[model samples]
Target: MEPDGDIEIFLVASPGLESVLCEEALARGFRDPTVIKGGVTIRGGWPEVWRANLELRGASRILARVAEFRAFHLAQLDKRARKVDWGAILRPDVPVRVEAACKGSRIYHAGAAAQRIETAIREELGAPISDDAEVQVKVRIDDDLCTISVDTSGESLHKRNHKEAVNKAPIRETLASLFLRRCGYDGGEPVVDPMCGSGTFVIEAAEIAAGLNPGRSRRFAFELLAGFDEAAWAAMRGAGGEGVDPAQITFRFYGSDRDAGAIAMSRANAERAGIAGLTEFRQHSISDLVPPDGPPGLVICNPPYGNRVGDKNSLYPLYGAFGRTLLSRFAGWRVGMVTSERGLAAATGLPFAPPTAPISHGGVRIMLFTTEALA
Candidate 1:
């Protein structure tokens, strides 16, 4: 595929959350994004690809679908793959890794397909192919159709570049942002995470409230592509940063954890992300959680499940105490809790509306349980 024309950009979503990512893409003004099975797709040029990498918070990674063709067998695939204009998108100086997957395709050997594409790129584009390359070329052969894409985001968007410190089994920023959206959070209201390990939710909330772009601090694989325009990318980023004044944001995001080290890490991460002034991190257990001095807001937490940290029998009391604390002290506040165990969530006794579709986090299927404002 040539880089001179409009490109199909795919925003990778965590499974079961494609609609949430689609909502974000539409809100961000991406042109005509359609929700697909695994992700959301939009059509645009290289600028759109760069902007998607820079402005989107919910996407795991952005892939630019550059080429699609019919290849009934290995020979056909090899011939067509060599004809692709790799030089238009790939750089000779930058290394690339080619990955291929086949399902119900006539040419079903994924390893051989990948090797063919790797050889084509190496011989045709003069680009080095390495397993460790940050630039990735993905080939999917489904039912004899070959689709090629480039992973534009070098690292997962969850890295966010500024969160250097993390607690055990911290929720990824991408998943946290989607969960916040699912709980009906916009930037207008304050957010509190009671069991804020590494403060993923709190920090993400603060950034969203301040109108900070999630990708502002990071570099993308697209920057090394042949079609990269540094000046245009810089202008887009500048415009995004100009939209919100962090100093003017009135609502404060709060996070509390029993471990003092987690609180310290949260504070440091907030500081690095430029939202420290808009957030508060304190060392406190779930039982000690209290609503800050403000109007009612959303309280979200990714607390531990029995499988991860402790035994289920011992955790029941913690959940019960958590439910009791909110019931007694946090009137008018809403709650969102994420846990892998249904029994643990049930132990809370909070009237959570039906749980969201289960999301995979940290290798376990978890769901978000949300409640209306407490009476």
Candidate 2:
């Protein structure tokens, strides 16, 4: 088991947007962040873990590597799991849930391995075990090396704790932020989402422009950890560059949806996010999408695809209408559209430069089709 002073923190990113997340971590001044296969790893202690959960918009969840050891079999795993100083990281008063996974390990039964760790924490540390515990201990046994990590961010970071209303096929806030970054958005200009499902892009743009921390409104599992200092955490949360003044914001984000319910949901979500002043939502169809009266900005949306929503032939007309509206009316505005089918993206004839690597959304592989600034 490693000392609690310098722990390894892993930032879980969506599969295709690892590079974008790495860029975000680097820009945020995480120490020695190395992009790994599934996520980004950084060396830090409790403060760094808390900060990562509070500040990072692209990370889906944060994991703190608490301990690792070699265990060839279930008996060895039980012996070593008992030796870990769980008291150093987990509070006895707070209940925890233990989850485990194994790959190429002699201790092939993940449930059995998890049971050993759970019993150790219960007996050795006197911590209660519950299936619905807010704090989670994740044990991974891969190739005979058993690593224990704690899920510092509970309920995933995308919930953001503000969006109460969602339409069908809502985009996660983490993915929305990454997609915005991929579109070269720097929080400088206006953004418009023609098919805003629940105002995710518009609200995310507003929040970024306002310099609001994505995790400000949420609670984390780390608060229940052993070494948590309430005063210190409060200070850290308060000591930061405050968000932009709503009055000072010059460009407002816009979203329009044909469904009035979606438009209502967007408005409600923006208000709850405290960025309502920086956003505008209207009930309008794609053919009615018009650029706001300002300098050009990125126009982005995650529209329905054939795989999930409707028949391909029916959606082509929607895509075509969307493209024609953008090309004919939104000159000088760049465009980014997310869809699972290339043919649907092509039907728009919007001159997309190239599609990004596929991203899994709702069991469908989707790609972002982007175009250069419209001529």
Candidate 3:
């Protein structure tokens, strides 16, 4: 990997959700992404890598190409690692952490492999290696081919630098954003989360509407690299806030939850995201989801699936009652609901056509049901 024009990026996603990440990458202008078991790999320039890091709500981390070589043993790995251009990526003063893993390869000793790479980086590049360092260099050896990548995202994208308050089983920002995109949210119409827990969807929606980049408030490891371009990054940060005013947006975002504590957390999270005024929170139940006084909009909800003890039988009736309420009152509104259990979704019985597609939510296999306005 010798400073080629385009960089190879690995877009990591939730388990069994590689296809969804691929679809999202394609939608975001990634060309011919290769879908692997747990992630999608794409080739792009530095700008694309930065934009993907900032805009891609589904990716766990965006890795950049540092180097690659073919090594059959430890000696060969050491020789090849020493000959590469480390000055291009790592400064001699900046400390780094080296992580290595081997799979289906002759070199099966992960600890020894990591030690070799760390020694090479330290001695050859003069870069300090530390245990608690933020900069990480990853080495993967598979089938006698060794690949090296740097973790561009220091912290996971889900830690959006906000959300000081959270509730039990809170929805991840990436999953919530993906579900919203799947529900066809174009930042044009009103939205609601009847069972909104911490207002993840509502805040993401407001950010999308206000043209705020999801990654603007956070920092990445790439920003600390040797040749990091500060001017280019500033331009990229400024690009997200164009042509949108939250005040003029006609869409009225709302959230409601049975737990008052959840509402308080949701409000606080919204305020931290700077979209508190753009969204409304209320302590209410599913039965109170009357159609908005304005236009009929999408109602996206990630209700509990009763996965704990004593939760199954007790929560089923809540699902049934929610279904009855939607059928009786929300006749002309579009409904998008996510739940881990198919039985709980089937309990809705809102006459949905079928799931658009199933997505992974919080380590469980979940399906989504969408229904158009009732006739």
Candidate 4:
């Protein structure tokens, strides 16, 4: 939680979730977020870290930079690593796990480098080291320049510690949050997921509408660091817990799945997230979907592609039917559809513009298409 200099905040996301990472950085008030290969890097302090963890649903983990130095080999690494006051960052009593990776560097042996760093932390700083550790410190040496990060989030943020029932091709919570943002989900408009599997999108939408922090109920590994601000964290958690409206949602979210079991599981997950009352889950096919009793709203869905189903050609008729139903039944409402196969999206017949960007989810590359002519 260094407050003086420019601190680095690393937001971990799924393979195809980079765009959402940048969008989240902007939404959370970060200026000019730059997306790297797999994550987003931004400059902020402890408050930003807290907000990112609490508010962002697309990030897998939020890491804070504690120290950085340049070293060509083990000797140089030992000198630089010993210079830093490790006691200020990690406590002597708390156990820690150290992981290191070296790429294109003179220090080719990663294990030896990690061992040297571990020696400095344990022997010099008196911190205990173990395989089963709650706090973890990661070291990355790229071309002889070392960057160390403290894993503020011990466990992956997607765990959320809530979902036990999942779908066959279930989408991760992080991906769902990003997809929702790319589709311009602002928490004030009605959202519908005709093929909602496991109810992730609908539940996330309801949480946004209810002003619930996505990370409020989870615990972080930073809590074990030395000089950790327990009172300040408690105050922040308490403040976040307040101002919750159990029944003051701004919009209605609807989700439906053809699978009866999926609908039942979605209901249970929504209830676990404390949004079951606000969300409606039903067992119905996309052909049977009708507009909810409200004004023209947003219809967002992640339809099945050939990845899990049998033949790609066989599902064209289903997509065509879905498109025909939308074209005929629901006019003047926006439709956002995500699919990996271009032909599958084309099968929908409704004229749609190509997605602004592409994202990778579950080892599949997916893009979004929105109908320009909602009417």
Question: For residues 91-132, what per-residue lDDT tens digits would candidate 2 score against the true structure?
Answer: 999999999999998889999999999999999999999999
Better of 1 and 2 by lDDT: 2
What candidate 4 gets wrong by more than 4 Å, as runs, is: 1-6, 15-19, 30-34, 242-250, 308-310, 356-358
TM-score of 4: 0.91
Best by lDDT: 2
Model 4: clashing residue pairs?
Answer: 16-360
Candidate 1 lDDT trough over 10 residues, lowest sum: 240-249
Tens digits of per-residue lDDT for model 3, 82-201: 887788878788899988999988888888888888888899889999998888998999988899999889898887888989887777888777667777776887888889898888
lDDT of 4 by residue, 134-235 (tens): 898889999889988888888888877667899977777877777778777778878889999888888888887787878888888878887677787778
For residue 121, model 1's alpha carbon misses the true position, in angstroms, by 1.2
Query: What lDDT tens digits, residue by residue, belong to model 1 across residues 1-375?
Result: 333479889999999999999999999999989999889999898888888998899999999998999999888898999999998989999999999999998999999999999999999989999999999999999999999999999889898998999998889999999999998898888999989989899999988888889999889888889978778788888987544776687779999989999999999999999888899998978888888887888999998887845577788988998999999999999999999888988898899998988888878899999999999
TM-score of every candidate relative to the true structure: 0.97, 0.97, 0.92, 0.91
CA lDDT of each candidate? 0.90, 0.91, 0.81, 0.82
Tell me model 1's lDDT, rounded to 2 decimals: 0.90
Worst 10 residues of 4 by lDDT: 242-251
Score candidate 3 by lDDT: 0.81
